[model samples]
Target: MFYQFPEDFYWGGASSALQTEGSDSSRGKTIFDVFYNLAPNRFFDGVGPNKLADFYHRYKEDISLYKAVGHNSHRTSISWARLIPDGDGDVDQEAVVYYHEVIDEFKRQGVTLIMNLMHFDMPAALQAKGGFENREVVDAYVRYAKICFELFGDKVKLWATFNEPIVTPEGGYLYDFHYPNVVDFKRAVQVSYNMIIAHAAAVKVFHQVVDGGEICTILNITPIYPRSDNPKDVAAARIADLIFVRSFLDPVLLGQWNAELVEFLGEHDLLPVGLPEDKQLIAANRVDFIGLNYYQPRRVKAKEHVPHPESVLLPESFFDYYEMQGRRMNTSRGWEIYPKAIYDMLMTIKNEYGNVKCYIAENGMGIQQEDQFRGADGVIDDTYRIAFYKEHLRYVHQAISEGVNCFGYHIWTPIDNWSMINAYKNRYGVIEFNPQTGERKLKRSGSWFKELVDANGFDD
Candidate 1:
């Protein structure tokens, strides 16, 4: 092996409740359920979350497959709606029993579990009441976190407050990709600020109730690059970074908002209001670690045209996406594949964020119509996916050699599951699932990953 990892390094994959577990009607409906009903055309092929990978009933089989693939650790999220049917009320006894069974199964397989308290699956009951935009929703989220801590924290040592906290506000409020499809900049800022507070509150509760458990949040950190060395372009990239990365990164990791971010929001009159104690709350409850979900880097240039003063403010208003001439791209998703961005991200964390403990929570390539890769031997020959993992893992190994405290690297998913807007169009799984028959087959990437895990690394 060219690049051996630490003996205790985590080797596994990640999945969320809504994406994998197929039990929507049994539990409380989420905003996703509501949105899909309202406009089924928005989703790919009109496939909703009603019936996903069926992990709810097939967790035992899934864990066996995970063990076969040499996964020493696994990450998954507990559905807020499933645990508490009404979003904020008495715990559902059935849900409690189900989760305990799942935890026990993982323990039976000797797989270390990293559980997230909330993914993007917010309960519709909460969404009906303005979701994160309302401060009351923060209290509701804290309550949910407390219940999770009291119930499952003893078994799950590693807990995440939320997964990609920025996506909620960015997609739902600003870009209209998620529920409540609003395009209000002020509401988006308010939602983002409230989510930070909610995360801090969850961390605070975790500390108060949980014993010997480490809590953190997963952030999708896409390093921003200037299109050119021009001063305006550089400034645009900086502003874009502040808006996308530092807005949540600073408060969670550094326990304070960046001065530049605050100034920019103030200048545009887009600051979230209320709770002078919010800063102290955030500072007092920093994460024990961080999770980086690196997929691609952002390339930005100065905006060619400024928006009218009366136009609503947005992060893209300060910068424009710059497409480089000869960049490697993922044709299925149209996302640039820059492996070095992982190294740069880790170096930034090491130099700027005090070298805090972190891990690659999610990273993988999603391809459309992957059935063509199957061979005569009944295996999917996903050599490109193998190469993608190798390239990214090389950078991860490089960062680790340089003393970055990254401990794990989990792929985006363990099995092909339903995506948000794309539905099941793109497959990012090591194991391929037959949507029609619910059949499972380990792909070539899965076999290769098993060898990599057993060897602790791979030869170049």
Candidate 2:
């Protein structure tokens, strides 16, 4: 079988400022580093995002690698602290030069750049002022996004206002996975509401200034399904989906907040205060595109137990995760393998959200293997990775045929980048990196990707 992509189909990879660019540059300190610094071991494996794939110094060589590996496009984010050393006022000249060089170098290699303005990297200075909880922070983001658009708008055509805006509130406020770890539902709702406002502000600036630039919001949209055909289970799945995906999607894409979400929050008295002008501002600037980062689907069902003060609580305390029977799993990261999730996500977008153009902004498998790539004939054979990507692409091809309107596909990362708390424990790169000596090496899957890019499809 041969599944060929369109002529304009994009072949590229993704990296984040916080994840790939080491924090040692004049980028200053982000809230991520500051929070974990307050308590180092609070993160997974006791390491923060400081120890990253030092792309700060190696971007020249890395950009060259991206070109050599057959990339027509690449996605990367700019650290807020890096640009504004104070997070609000003066911009850093040294940081500006570095990023310009990186962006220019990519352009020289004939690669289109998709620049994300913020990717969970809040400047420590901004975090000092209550982060996303403050409306002042929203104003700061609009100014910052404007600066980026004015500076890089000519070269970069695509801009992302925020990456997975809900994840920060969910992980930091609701769940205990991220910093300022709190278990308050009201604060989570507040933070989420403010982030949406911030996103709308950025999009408004993008449309007003940048003549040809398009701004979109990136989301880690997970599809939720019920355990059985039971009515309660099905209803729970719909509510969870609303809270997770549509909560942000509706406001940004459809130019209005989800009425159901507002009604639900109003029932709990969790709605944030906003004026009539604020409502107009949000409804004016709708997104031109979407960036979908799909790795796993969420399988949920109605919760069996009632909430108690002593219970381990989360935002989704009303639902229970029901692992599908006989489902395949990524043993390395323990994520369920559900290829159909991507297809369903595309169809859902088309059916519910007007089939807006989108791209698979991030998709990759993470493993725990390190220093295990020895060659039989001078080549490390990573067949499992090759298979992992192929299976996903097949599904994407199916989506394309079904008129999903996806423009491109980007793997989660180009090189082995850092995770917030996981440190270097997980491997999710086509290009493997050596943490011991800061060496960069392409795995067998990297070569396979080059072939896939050259062919513009997969044949099996």
Candidate 3:
């Protein structure tokens, strides 16, 4: 092996319950279901989150695929709607049994199970009263977290409170890309603050209940860069980083919000009113580790003009997105392919933060029109995906060698599953899923990943 990892380094892939598991009818409705039902046209191909990859009925087969891929650890989330149905009500006994069976099967296969409490799938009942904007919803979420720790904490050692906590506010509140789409900057800030508090509450409960279990939250960290060395551009990038990256990162890791962020929010009159004990809870319950989902870097320049007084306020109002000329891009998914960003992110966490333990929670390429790559043997020859992983892993390996405390690397997913809004437009999985026939086939990247995991690394 050209670059070997530590003996116990985790090698696996990730999935979310709402994206993979089907049987939506049995599970209670989520805010996503309500949103899709209200506006099915908003989704690509008019496909909502119904009967996704059917992981609910096919988890045993999926676990077999994980074993075949040489995965020692797997990251997935539990569906709150499936588990508790109404979000704050009696537990669904069937859902509990199913999760236990799934955990036991992973243990039998020698795969470490990493379970997440939430992944952008809040129950519809909770969202009816303003989702995270309502303090009652925060208490409901804490209750759900407690139930999870009590029920399955023994089987799952690694638990994440949430996945990409920023997405909830950004997509739903600001961008109108998710459920209960509301375009309000103040609500966005409130949602962000409430989520941080909820995460702290979950961490506190995890510590109180789960013995010998580690708790963390997953963040999609994208280092922002200025278009030039100009001070204004640099400042724009800095502010963007504060809003997107450090807003949640600082609070979860350091147990306090960033000073600059607080000042900025206060200046704009967007600061959320903290609960009496919110500060103390956040200060007391910090995470044991972090899970970084890095894909691209954000390049920004100073805004060309000031926004009108009546214009909607946003972090982007102070900065303009700049696309670097001649940079490589994944045209299929319309995202920049910057492998070094992972190295930069890991280094930032090490230097700026306290060098906390971390892992590559979700990182992979999503390609459209993948069927064209199928060869005569009927196998998808996704060599581009292989190259993508190799490039990113090289940077990840560099960071690990530099003492970044990054212990694991998991791809975005093990199988192609349904994505929100985009539906099944882009596929980011080692195993190809045939939606027409419900069959699974290992792509070339799957075979390559198996080899990479088995050897711990690959030769140049």
Candidate 4:
């Protein structure tokens, strides 16, 4: 079978600002910087945000490399901390000029650049004042969004509000892996609620400012699977899906909170403090599309035991993770390699979520220390990466064929970039990056991708 894709389909990759752009152009401090300062050892090799893939200095060359590697479209972020120092302060003229040049470069190379507003990289100045936990920070973020729209909207028609926004509150407040580490359930709820408001406010502002641009949110959607056909396991899976997936999905696409989620939170006395007008604001500003970042599936089961009434509460307090025996796993990242979950997710979107226009924002395998796979000819023989893409793309094609509104497929990244805590431990890129000398080389997967994008499909 000749597995073909739709005409005008977007074919490219996705990345973020702080992950790729090293601290440059008078960039202000970010939450990652603060975290590294507090606990440098937590990150791989003790690498920090200040040290990155150096996209800030090497974007021109890197863009050329991505284009050559067959990227007709790409997704990346505009650093809020870089553009407006402190998140709501003086606009950095140097940052402005730098971003302008970068966007122009993408246009010059005939690549569509989708600029994301935030990717868990909040400005430290705003974060210091409570980050998303503080209502004032929501306004600051909206203002930042407006500035980005007016500045880059002319050249960049595609924009995203946040990339995997759940990680912000989930990591920082619930798990304490991020800066401003706090383990308060109420605080986490408040942070997530504020982000919803912030996203809606930005959507409202974008329509008011930008004339002809499409704005969306990038959500990391992992399909939840029940351990068995038992009702308790199914219930656990449903609630977990509600908490992780629908929490943001409902608000952005349906323009309202999941009713069951709200009632459950209220019953548990865990609802975030909000205003009546907040609902109206959210209801009025739904996104134009969605970018679903699928990496793995989550296997869940009913709580193995009742939580102590006096103990602190968490999402896991109601459910337990189920490790399936003989499940296909990615040893490099410890994630399940279930490509069909992509099809299941898209079907759910079509059946339940109004079938919103969407695309595969990020789907790639991360292998640790890929340099060990390099051949004598200076090429990484990453046949595994190519096989991984083929498997996932087949599912993506199946979903589109069945009318799931999936428009494109973008891998996790175009080149090796820094990940939070992991740094560059797991390389998820078609192109390799040399951190020290800023060198790049096309891997075996890179050559394969160029052909795949050029043809818009591959044979089965």
Candidate 5:
């Protein structure tokens, strides 16, 4: 490989609480159940999150697989329901034992654990009480964060407060893709603000309590590209970027929200409600780094047709999404394949957000292939996935060379894990698992990744 990453460069894989852990009910209810039960058709194949990868039982075996694949670091989330059954009151003893064992086993295997405190798994018990929109939910989240820091702070050095906190407001509240499906911009802004406060509160507690741990927030940043060279389209792209990417990154990293976003919210009368001290909390608890999960770019243009003047207004009412023509796309998930977006995102973080230390925390393609382990060879020739990883990684190398504070690369998952709605609908794993029988098999890409790690680069 021409672009050799730095020595001691971390290479790993990432998974979430609701996606891989199968013991959803072993502790308590979560927002996943609320969404699925409300609208089963929204999920791919109509499968819920109950039957995840069963990592709760098979994690010991899974960590060994991580070693086989040359992963020195592994990222996984702790389930809130598992820790506090109702997301507030008492810590579950069973969950504490299981997670401690998992962390210790990883240490025994010489792998570093990057633990995320929450990953969209709001205990359904809390959602029934208004979820993040309610102030009490923020207090519950702070308590949960405190418990994790106190319990696992010694072993876990890298702590992520929340994984894609903005997605709840964007996908769940404003777009109706998740539970408590309400399409209200005002409510979305309120939820987004609350999540930021919750994150700050968690970070404050982590710093106050956890002595030697570092904390960061994960954002699934989709770089926005203008449809054409038209200046109006360019302005629209900037607005979209301000709304989607900078909305959270600015506050978390720069210690304040973007002025453009604040002004836009003011124009719409959707400015978030915050206590006077909330600003002080956010400003005080700035993160040490950022975890950028870039998969694709968002193509945008100015809205061409204005809605009826008398109609009810929404965010979409002002902007129209204009997908760029002839852009590369991921075939299975139908997501636009824009590897360059990763480089652009890093550049933006460097230029606009003060060049904070960050990493490609989650990036991978989801493939729908059934014959991944169909032969006596027990090997999957996942050439497409290999290509996806290499192309995206090339961009990371380019960004690193250009002075982006890029640290490491963690693919979306290590093994084929289950998703909340789709339930193993797509595969983005280096290691392919027979979800039916719990058989672990390394795909050809897994071997390729191991060589990449061993050689410190891909040789041409």
Candidate 6:
């Protein structure tokens, strides 16, 4: 086989409490539950988070399937609202028991657990108190992280402070897809700054409480591609990369801020206000490792027009999106299918970022109406999904061969689960979670993944 992974490399999938755990009655309300409750019609098919893969109740069976599919590790999340009920105050013993049961079952199945602290499911109680925008919320998050580390650190092999922390500021404050929707760039910068503080403080907590487990932060990096060879277009891509990529990446991995980003935000008068202590806290609390998630590449061109006087300035005010002609795309989600972006990103980390230990935390293909591909033999023959995995994994192996300090490869998920606004409009899992029948059946891609796991690679 031309594509082979290391002997002890992790091979499995990733899931979040918001997407997989079902029946919102047992846990405290998340902002997602509140948003879906307010406007179900805004989501696809009017389905809310109450519709999920039922991992809360069926995690044993789910773990068994994970082992059956030849998994050695799985990255999952612990719900703050589930574990603590509120952001602070009291702890829920019942939720603690449930998580212990789930973690024990994963151990029995010989699957290593990589637990994440937050996955966009902020407790509604905290949201009511200004979420991450307030310094009080940062302290509360550190408390939550300390509890999680002390309670479950013995069993969990690795810890991640936040999964794609940038998405919260981008989706909730910049865009309106998430709850507490506000489009103020100033507030978004504040929220983003506070999250960095929270993450750094959480990393400090993880080290103090946990004995030896390393902590990381997962980032979804979409490589920005310039429209042409012109210096203006290249400069636009650089700005976009600083905003979307470096804003989170630099602080978490390098323990410093990008001076250019600071200058840009200062010029716009959008810099976040913080205390004197935050700079040192962020610099001293760099992560033990990193997790990189990639799905698509973004194309950008130099701005063609100046913003109107009445319009609010945004990151898009500097760069315009360009859809390249003849580029491959995933028609279901309208995402570009440029798998080689993974290799490029890995190389960048090697050359510029000190080659910190990292892994492919997520990479997957989502297609609409997967039932259309179901075969008569009671399996979904998702060859396109298979092709997606093959191409992406090939780049991963190539990067590994070039000595990129990369380890492990986990897909977006093993079973289809609840997505915020989209619900289950697009399926990205190898194991089919049938919402109609409430049963999970292995897709053809699942079997192919098992082969990949067993061989630790693929044949040319």
Candidate 2: lDDT of 110? 89
- In terms of lDDT, model 6 sits at 0.90
Give each model's whole-structure lDDT: 0.92, 0.85, 0.92, 0.92, 0.86, 0.90
Model 2 stretches with alpha carbons more than 4 Å out: 309-313, 377-379
TM-score of each: 0.99, 0.97, 0.99, 0.99, 0.96, 0.99
Cα deviation of 260, candidate 3, in Å: 0.3
lDDT of 1 by residue, 394-429 (tens): 999999999999999999887999999899899999
At residue 293, candidate 3 shows an lDDT of 97
Clashing pairs in 1: none
Q: After superposition, how far is residue 220 of candidate 3 from its true place, in Å?
A: 0.5
Q: State the local distance difference test value for candidate 5.
A: 0.86
Ten-residue stretch with the least lDDT total in model 2: 370-379
Which 10 residues in a row give candidate 3 its minimum summed lDDT?
23-32
Clashes of 3: 0
- Residue by residue across 207-305, what tens digits does model 6's lDDT show? 888888899999997788999989999999999999999999999888988999999999999999999988899999999889999999989999999
RMSD per candidate (Å) reads 1.0, 1.6, 0.9, 1.0, 1.6, 0.9
Candidate 2 lDDT score relative to the true structure: 0.85
Clashes of 6: 0
User: What shift in Å separates residue 316 of candidate 1 from its native position after superposition?
Assistant: 1.0
**Taking the tens digit of each residue's C-alpha lDDT, what string does model 2 give over 344-441?**
88888888889999989988888887447557654556777789888888889998998998999999888887788777888888787877778888
Residue-level lDDT for 349 in candidate 1: 92
Off by over 4 Å in 3: none
